[model samples]
Target: MANTPSAKKAARKIERRTEVNRSRRSRVRTFLRKLEDALAAGDATQAQAAFQAAQPELMRAVTKGVIHKNTASRKVSRLAARVRKLSA
Candidate 1:
């Protein structure tokens, strides 16, 4: 329970930030899922395009503090490798 006015305001702020972070996380996941779906379908061109679209979103999530920098980079690297393998 937030008894103090300041505490109540902070709680409200936290609630709003939580919603925003959740939305950002969901958007990033959607981009990742699109890339995964394209990869699973075995379409190299589509996968490449999806990866292109997702790479920036992942990085953006990192910048927004929604995910870690190394985590985003690792995911991008792995996905790029898979896309390259698909093309080859």
Candidate 2:
């Protein structure tokens, strides 16, 4: 339990931030899922489009502090490679 008013407020703030971060994370995952689906379907054009769309979402999450920069970069790199391989 929160003992003081300040502690209670902090807890409330944390909850709010958690919700926001969760939403951000979910949004990123949704974008990734779209890309994944496109890749799984083996539609190079659709996958390329999805990849283009997903790249910014990943970077946006990074900028928003929802994900680490390197993590986002690595994801982008791997996905780009998959997209390239599919296209080639």
Best by TM-score: 2
As a whole number from 0 to 100, the lDDT of residue 84 in candidate 1 is 98
Candidate 1 structure quality by residue, lDDT tens digits, 1-88 = 9999999999999999999999999999999999999999999999999999999999999999999999999999999999999999
Candidate 1 C-alpha error for residue 17, in Å: 0.4
- How many angstroms is residue 14 displaced in model 1 relative to the true structure, after the best TM-score fit? 0.5
Give stretches of model 1 more than 4 Å off: none
Model 1 scores what on Cα lDDT?
0.96
> How do the residues 1-88 of candidate 2 rate in per-residue lDDT, one tens digit apiece?
9999999999999999999999999999999999999999999999999999999999999999999999999999999999999999
C-alpha RMSD by candidate, in order: 0.6, 0.5
Worst 10 residues of 2 by lDDT: 56-65
Q: After superposition, how far is residue 7 of candidate 2 from its true place, in Å?
A: 0.5
lDDT for 2 (candidate 2): 100
Highest lDDT among the candidates is held by which one? 2
